[model samples]
Target: MASENQIVVLDGATARTGTGCMHGISWFVAKLGSTLAGLAADLDASLPSTLMTSIQAVADQHRATCDLLHPGTPSAVVALLRLNETVLEYLVLGDVTVIIDTADGLQVVADDRVDRTARAEREEADRYPFGSAEKQAALLRMKHAELAARNTPGGYWVAAADPTAARYAITGKIPLDTIRRVAVLTDGAARLVALFKLMDWPDVLELLDQHGPTELIRRVRAFEAADPSCMRWARNKRSDDATAVYAV
Candidate 1:
């Protein structure tokens, strides 16, 4: 007789104006035809939609004719996987991250977006005050981005664009046959994940195990309420978009 089968799930999220990354990974996932469309619409259409649409408009005017434009305003997201024994593969454009709880601690996997060019951009920012530098950088980045759009014309990522231009791209292929669980998250969730001395799915699962999803978000709200500074990470560090998910 067959044993109790395992479950696999693939979850993900996106923002309009990242480094044009969600589509690349989403394209791969959609091609794989796994559990769900990696970069689908947000559940909280009322709030996420408004922010995405508003931010995306500003990002649109930023592309250069040579670069790939973001399809819409960047939004955070989370994706999950529930499967028996198999392999897990994933990719990211912006900061959306993947954590694998292996025999070791939480293994954070990310893509190559912050390269030499990105480093140079950062160095330039250091030359000025954080606020003014951010504004100037935003403007310059958008200026070059606009040039890319002109060259590419209708070219853009995932049929959208975002203004902030924050992004990351990361993917992983793992042997799920031995793995116990996996979690996918955007920058927002990452903030909460860091709160723990040990950031692992078991912790998250434990929270979900005791309370429900509502409670998890509620905890986050309460946590945010207490520190409030923590939310700043969601705004400044992981600012663009956020999402998180887990599957065992």
Candidate 2:
């Protein structure tokens, strides 16, 4: 949860193989979030510096625990925030989002480079029937291509085992007094506004204020359940893990 001082949210990379090191990814990300929050609170460090340090710490720990640390070795999206007396600082790495409600309007911050790369694959996969071998194969190819391009100049970046990816984070500062509320959400939960487009950001904030996070995610799940074949939602998976933190 975010308070007057800071916030952090993480979503583990989607894992395929049952034996992949991603089994420990949730643990790794939680630890990394703790490390990041502590640094921001204690040192009052710059956003980039805190992210860099946290990334290195988690990557080293992941390497020590897992025998192999390859591109597929489980990574997570990083969404962090620091609140100062007059402004709010943010660092967003990968697809997770930071949504802010300002006095003027709502602001959304996300990294869509990764999503853009996956779009082509999603289109191809969507051509095949659901639960078919062709669709599965197409999805596999897409994952491989995405893995190959990770951390590259033309490709997108994530908080994987590479500390260098930290430098690629999207960052900015917003005037504190201008903001009425903020929400940090994993992509899964963000689908309410981003992928599903069921409502705009303002509606989302209104829902959060009225019903809270659970009601928002409940609507998402209900929508997915209605379209089992994903003809309506058209996504890589029927559902992904959803998580969110709302602060006011």
Candidate 3:
């Protein structure tokens, strides 16, 4: 749900969609955090400013569509927060989740990726590789994208039918004094919370403290490497597009 066409922080928030969208507009904004790793194409820096531009673009498009049709609007969109910047802010659409780090430790700030449709798709795809090698051979036994598409949803939200569109934001932030270090990972990595019996932010933060974010990312990658080609699409708890952003 991140809208990052270009990089840099903006100084203002403007509504680009809807009538009177200004008064109640939820413009993306947040206090910038430390150690940023954003994904413009591969990645970038700054959270608040970058997202403002992104959300504005989406809103503008939505307004334009609405203009074309009587009150037409595109799906709500969420912008990615720049990791470290002068301010902190982000936008979201769908269900991509954003976690923030505070003195109490880590906590969820926003969610904007996946949905019921996406979940069902993940479950069916889980039976295959990308999760387990058996999955590939099993899928190979099938036939084409049509069959696999049937296994999941239309492949729009769940299946990686398209990689370019598959990339998305899982966590974003500008964790200030409340947190010392933080980690932003896609829902796939967070899935370890239940499957592996790990705790939420605090618990994760504890583990992160002991092992360090570098090690944390390394472990996650190890799991990814072990999986078959279907790893990115594994239906298991932690098998969608995998990404992790850690910082203090």
Candidate 4:
């Protein structure tokens, strides 16, 4: 979602088989994204404050029909950039990446607490072959561990039923004059560097400069197709929802 002054990208979580929400992940992300964008447009609030209000608003819409406290309930990682006259205000929560091409160099803002949590279980899951029953069992254990850590102190935070998670988002301002370009990417699109080791951040920015955002995502899909079994680049899913927004 983008407008004259703001850009918003949301990566909705993959719905679990038994998510306690009455709505799907798509519904959650669509509502949350629109609400956040609307609030940001109408209110003179900070990025995090607008996000908090949006989450609370969405929760109010579904609270009576769904189990809001369930860990598996609908959630999303957020990447937001608001352009001001002299500065750019940005917010990142969960794994979404916001890359800034500035006069000094490239700056990346992302939250990695999810990777820091459930270490043992994730390692165990990695030990088993992908698509095997053993791997599935290990992944289940990892999921449970992740659920236990979600939104807790020292754990990762995402945009979910808890409005307070907005407080944990990475937020800051960068001088607008120093920025040459900006790219906001969901984790799926970032897998090119973060997971596949295909390129560095500079390389990614260069790619975006030369080819554009669609080509970046196309390359990611090509790589995933080449390694369909996850043998070369191990991952939880073969293909994820990839999205990218580039601004100059």
Number of the top candidate by TM-score?
A: 4
Predictions in order: lDDT: 0.39, 0.80, 0.39, 0.89
At residue 159, give the lDDT of candidate 4. Answer: 93
Q: What is the TM-score of each candidate against the true structure?
A: 0.43, 0.91, 0.42, 0.96
Superposition error at 188 for model 1 (Å)? 1.3
- Residues 1-248, candidate 4: write the lDDT tens digits: 99999999999876534678888899999999999999988536899999999999999999999999887988899988998778899999999899999999899998888999999998888776677888788888888888788888989999999999999999999999999999988999999999998798889888998999999999999999998777688777788999989889
Summarize candidate 2's per-residue lDDT along 34-98 as a digit string, tens digits: 87777878535778888788888876765655744565777788888888768988899999888
Give a tens-digit lDDT track for model 1, residues 1-248. 01133212222233223444433445433332221232222322222233234334433433432133343322222222223137554434334456677655566664323222334443444344324546456536543443343213242222134422212223345676556655565445555565432345567656654664455555555555654432333222213223445555
Clashes of each: 61, 0, 39, 0
Candidate ordering by TM-score (highest first): 4, 2, 1, 3
What tens digits encode model 3's per-residue C-alpha lDDT throughout 205-240?
Answer: 666667765665565656655654644534333434
- Candidate 1 overall Cα lDDT vs. reference? 0.39
Indicate the residue-level lDDT of 163 in model 2. 78
Q: How close is candidate 3 to the true structure, as a TM-score?
A: 0.42
Worst 10 residues of 4 by lDDT: 13-22
Better of 1 and 3 by TM-score: 1
- Highest lDDT against the true fold, candidate: 4
Better of 1 and 4 by lDDT: 4
